[model samples]
Target: MIHVAQITLETKGPRLLFLRKEDPVRFTWYEDLVQEEKETEVFSTTALEAIRLAYLYWKNYSFKTLNCGFRYTLPERDEHGNNALFHQMIASYSSMNGIYFDEDLGHNCFVNFASDEAKNLWKNLQSQKRL
Candidate 1:
């Protein structure tokens, strides 16, 4: 049986906190998701502008940005052997939901779990025994 971890988010003011639970009291937290309320609020204004420009490159394009939290693994020497396998399992399941790996960003190695569509997709795929 494949066991996948869960992603939880806590929004405090404009900063978003990401968490992953393991043991009862052990929770790993890292990274922050800041709401881009204004153009200046974005960390990389230039990058954001570039993305917006590229997004508009396609005609009649409708971009839907969803808040799908991310799941992170510990930085360990044997991460590839242990964590990678587990992460892959989670990511595979996440892909069934609308969540995906943000390869364009530095978060390429991490799994992003967000989107109810992805959750439904994963459920359907599981029912079909394709996953």
Candidate 2:
């Protein structure tokens, strides 16, 4: 019963709560908090699995760019001097995975895990700098 939500301006319905568009996506794992908010989409089994799926989505987008004449060695920069390829990959990944994304406002990927294992997994990923 893990719940996941993306902070976005758009709401799926009246029940969905919207966070500020600029808020960064965060991983939260607490039963009481989730219990308080009953409208969140209850999907996903664990935070680790959700994160791994996101990574795979990113990897899938990277492969698509490589095939589209984007360089793997030297990535092209966007107008903001950010890596264009990386942004593109992130956009694709976020959209495909039901995370919120805005070209101007930016994307924030948020997740809520229902189990203690998910909390440990998040801490482990953070310690390893893999998140």
Candidate 3:
């Protein structure tokens, strides 16, 4: 399972903290993330709760945004005999006048997840809506 520790969002985008559940020892720590990402915020929790909590806060200020989008990791394997880190992302923009045009950006993309549970966790996050 992927343990979501913290989530930080700025004018740029959202940053999520996660740790490989079963392989904490060999969990390769990646540096090069932004300054807001801190090791001190590790909550050792799941993605659902983290996302739910974030939605509560983001919705308060993101009033102009009427639509939400998400990316989900796929479970299929690639030709290398390894789990393919494919992902899907979709977007639906709503206008104040009620007109809308959607985009399925997930058409061609690859993603990396800590584990299979991370994929399931992302699906749960997608089910939640604030607007």
Candidate 4:
């Protein structure tokens, strides 16, 4: 099961405090802590919430001019595998605007912004120090 937590734009921007400043997209997965384990892998809590908020705010400010798209993949794993996989994709009307988050059930999560528009929106959200 994929669990997602979201923050609405109308709410004060303090919710982003949960994220680390130098790297807002990456966060520790507190629920997965196993003291006995020799190693713990840090992960994103799924940046869907942040991305959605930014997308909504951008969409509103853009007068709903462009259509955005979202794709979700269910968590899955092979019977012989020990971990599950999760994936998410977002795109805008223009092929130039999009982002991809591939959480491969490991320490190295991949994030890519297809265009500057998508990158700017993420930056704008993270930089909201007062709003």
Two-way lDDT contest, 2 vs 4, winner: 2
With a 3 Å backbone cut-off (N, CA, C), the pairs that clash in candidate 3 are: 85-111
What's the lDDT for all of these models? Answer: 0.35, 0.30, 0.32, 0.29
Best first by lDDT, ranked: 1, 3, 2, 4
Worst ten in a row by lDDT for model 1? 36-45
How close to the true structure is residue 32 of candidate 3, measured as C-alpha lDDT?
17
lDDT of 3 by residue, 24-111 (tens): 3332111115433233222224434433443464454341211122323234324342222112212211124322232232332333
Writing each residue's lDDT as its tens digit, candidate 1 over 1-131 gives: 11222223243322222232334443332223332211111121243343344335322333222233344533321233222222243564456553445343334344444457445634654686534
Using lDDT as the measure, which candidate wins?
1
Candidate 4 error regions (>4 Å): 1-104
User: In candidate 2, what are the lDDT values of residues 51-116, reduced to their tens digit?
Assistant: 344335334233111111121211222223222222233333335553434344344432222234
* Collision count for each candidate, in order: 4, 0, 1, 0
lDDT value, residue 42 of candidate 3: 22
Model 2, TM vs. native: 0.18
Tell me which of candidates 3 and 4 scores higher on TM-score: 3
Q: How many backbone clashes does candidate 2 have?
A: 0
RMSD of each: 16.3, 17.1, 15.6, 14.3
Q: List the residue pairs that clash in candidate 4.
A: none
